[model samples]
Target chain A: MNSNTRPVADPRPAFVENPEQADQQQALGRRIITDGIRTVFLVGCGGSLAAYGPSVYTLDNRVPQLVVQAMNSDEFNYRKPAGLGPTSIVLVGSHTGTTAETVRAIDTAKAAGAESVVSLTSDPESPLATHADLAFTDRPTKWAWDPKEIAMARITQGILDAAGLAASGFDEALAALPADIPNVFADLDPALHRIAEDLATKPVTYALGSGPMEGMARAFAMFYMQEMLWRHAAAYNAGEFLHGPFEMTESQAPYLVLCGEDATRPMTDRALGFLNRYSEHVHVIDSREFRLAGVPDGVRAEIAPIVMSAVTTRLAQHLEAVLDHDLSTRRYMFSVEY
Target chain B: MNSNTRPVADPRPAFVENPEQADQQQALGRRIITDGIRTVFLVGCGGSLAAYGPSVYTLDNRVPQLVVQAMNSDEFNYRKPAGLGPTSIVLVGSHTGTTAETVRAIDTAKAAGAESVVSLTSDPESPLATHADLAFTDRPTKWAWDPKEIAMARITQGILDAAGLAASGFDEALAALPADIPNVFADLDPALHRIAEDLATKPVTYALGSGPMEGMARAFAMFYMQEMLWRHAAAYNAGEFLHGPFEMTESQAPYLVLCGEDATRPMTDRALGFLNRYSEHVHVIDSREFRLAGVPDGVRAEIAPIVMSAVTTRLAQHLEAVLDHDLSTRRYMFSVEY
Candidate 1:
């Protein structure tokens, strides 16, 4: 497939035609979130929950009084920690609402006297939604490059709106995303493609970053690189990169760093400089431009990282596709216990 | 060497015997933290900050007025986000205290008007410590294990004490850790040793858990399996294990899960159950016994997970040693760039 063309397996429908549906869902999510809940608890399992961390951190920092907890439903239902009260608002995210523990969590929260529940899921009719006070459907088609990115973008915006925080910028960002992402990916495609192509034959790979982006680097390196590309890859934070990982770097070894625009930028730059000193195999996705200049005014700079994250990841998906890696074809190595 | 035998290179002597020194350094850290008046930003690179997430979350949730921000210093210094004041506290951590970016972060924080600096380092003479207003030293000789765990325990206690909250039990728990950890590791040594021996030749491994223990599992698996053993490994929360990892769980893959005594026990159990259905090649370090029966009573159950984390990790360390892995052989696969 050509770099600019959509993949043959493009499963997601274009968002242009469904403007009304997106707006309605966004409005509903906002209403549910803004209505009388002093604190918000986002609950999910696995990647779903992992994805919520940045959003939670963003929202929590923006509105210090808004308590955001990323609790795995399985843990909440099983461990039952103290401090939850009737005033707490529970936001549950499960791609498939059929996740048993998530469904049980909603039920448990209601029983425990939670004030409200907001469910984010791909399946509107999933059990969690059925029990939820409000549900935000995340229906991204499988072939939309990175479906989770779009889903998380929407979910994050909805959560922010619900908190009475300004989310129009995020809404605007996502609306322009389909157009912006492809360009960003096109720009970085060559580098990532080279990395991906080389990674295809490598026995191992590492993705390094610092700050909030560490989790992203890890997810991509471990999940995408290993799962999609079937390669051995590891992720490290820029600071920790030197503690022990530097010794593993050599002329033949390749690593990628996600240098997002954050306080960690300088440190990451220095760390990357050190890496470059050791070997020329290091590649970095300089996110400073998108991080500082890309976001529209009035949007919290802290949250800008989220959008920049979207762009970088979009590039990652293109690179993966260029390498002809299929995410669906990979089978999970282990069954989820709960 | 027998499991009971200590390594000749044990670095514990330099730090452990000098509790008063540690206390003095901690006091200095508190002074820097307090004197750095504008904002208190807790900067850490990767696992160092992540290990402190729960505590940061707690502080943010309970004391919103503190102006505490946990970020990777690498991002902070480079991005140069405005609002950093001279009174700001930049708390950075680098085990060796020589991470280039971290050192730069201290410099940037100072330039940004950060008046006081505090650092956690295994090497008291490292640049980060030398430059800091206060520094906590934890000079562990063995690279196989991290002393940050102890530093974090101390830091968390200090935070609690500073906040005037009830922290007596937590303090006691920290004191009891050294003895408890070695004992638990000795008991679980045989099982872990056998598993390590079997997996010595394996190319990849996965560590699974949920809740706070999830981070611990990831840190250990990545450090031991990837760094020490030079084998590939990934860590995932139990709840997410089934999402994409199950496919790799054929009879050939090796998986380890840490089942700590936390609210996630049920989820961990459920995860274990699911993994059992897919494959029998799973190992577990059940930590409930240590939490419930072994820990002293005054410690809060909420903190039990943190206390028992040492035990579980010690087991992992023993396993690596038993498998004839050299704890000091440092491998660098990549360097961090700013």
Candidate 2:
């Protein structure tokens, strides 16, 4: 089932060679703290937004004194947060460096008097990166998410250190990712294929995850299940699933619960317990089942989404196998032009 | 078409008579600011989460000195934010005051050494109200939402006053709701039926809105459309809609776009521009179309969700008419144990 589209190898990040930009970002982080900056807005769209999921999940724990808000790029362009001007920094990311909403958000942030506008994109020549006050570029790849994860970890640690919270930083934990990320694909789970086979026949599918893993589950449901396979699917936060969306659960309802190592495991376990009673096809992708010996326990809790992403990527591949649907097929994405 | 189960009469809130609780809530709000509270956690689940939409939308615009984070009750219970205890007040509201997750969260906040636990619920006997350090109760209603809005406005204004930012408060503006709210149903919208009829047959529907109205659109799609009619519908914030859900849009795909008059209108309008190209069955519930003459221009931009909710209530009734299905019809709600 492996095709040319499948990311077959681990791609190196371009930023590794460009240490100057990394230093500048760290300096910007220190400046924010020194200037008494009250807010740090992390803005992006789609996969770019999901890229920051881990940082969003872990930043507060590392720097409780800092206020961080993750904003959808377009939302930030319109609903400019109060005091977002000279007192704040707008950190944005786009893969192609051509995501219109993100480019516009950078312009909007500058106009709103933001002290700094920083961007992360794959294409250095792309407007999203070229027009920013500070921009970091990486070579684009469909399957490689480690670059973004590393970039975010660096930025997060910078801010944490500037806030005098280096003792609680995640630098060492993130450094272990280069080795651990590759190991996620070394051993394949056959249950991933069985889950895909069950979901291929179901018209609607739901994904559930706790804390950091929630965003990864959402990306799988939307990007893989819906966009890749053209299946009706959506992801809900574990706690939210216990609220109204749980009503949709029925006998044989297809559900993929991403159980990661986190403080919220009890909540996800509770949700899974209830889901077990309702659906025969309820499948669990528990990180506990995996042997991620390269990653430390402390970092394991935060990077659960990255691990889930690696597993779901396999599920997406297997879905292509059983459904006989090409992962590249699309009616509207790049075809008819929506 | 209105039946016995329908709430045809306008239910006035009991808060008008019970001003003491409101006064106490105001004092708590001020104390939160005066005591140098660094974090304000707004927590709830389901409709109660939507109830805080406007405050969540407009609070930062008015009170830049304070930090506000809206959290799901269950999520808060497990993944407690780093700065949640001692210096933070968990402001929670539950209509029935007996939701287990929210009740558990109240206990969690107290256990975490929260400076204050303030609650707003209708059932005084419920543990949520009884166990709170300060609790405000309103008489229950099936359709009315003004009491919560008024209460939030008062609490928000008190916090603003303490922070020396009360000049931008909307207390008087929200007071106009009891008068303006009744007028929403005085004249029904014909477009509501047209939208409902077009949506009745679709297997899946999407609702999009910005800011406060985002929550309203979500409630209309999930609670009203899915829960009441057993139709598949979901809502996305305008910016979020552009990210991934837009991939689902196709020719004739039914969409209900809630165009509210707020700072985020441009964002929603941008999304609508793209949705218009993809779906012919796009429907707009523009607050600008309403004659909300009683609502002041200043506050009209803030309460678009409340206005949209009024029209959506009408749409719910019309959907029952078009589908020949009762709004109360449910496969398992209250009838089956989960």
Predicted candidate 1 versus true structure: per-residue lDDT over A1-338, tens digit per residue: 23443352332333332455566556644654666555556777655665665665465445534445666677667644333557577777777777777888887788768887778677677787778987766565423433444544565576566666754576656555566555555565566566655655566677777666776776676556655555566677776665445554567677777776554555467668777877667777776444233345555344444544554455446545655655546554333323
The lDDT, on a scale of 0 to 1, for candidate 2 is: 0.74
Q: Which candidate comes out best when scored by TM-score?
A: 2
Best by DockQ: 2
| Candidates' chain A TM-scores | 0.77, 0.87
Query: Model 2's chain B TM-score?
Result: 0.88
Tens-digit lDDT track for model 1 on B1-338?
23443332222221253577557644543553355443557777655665564455344433423445666655566555333556566678877687666888888877867766778777888998898877877665434234565565565555545555534566566565656655655566667666765555466777887776676677666655556655566677787665545545666667787776655667678778877876667887776556233355655444555644554455456645655566556544333333
- Scored by lDDT, model 1 comes in at 0.60
DockQ for candidate 2? 0.47
TM-score of 1: 0.74
Interface RMSDs of the predictions, in order, are 5.3, 2.6
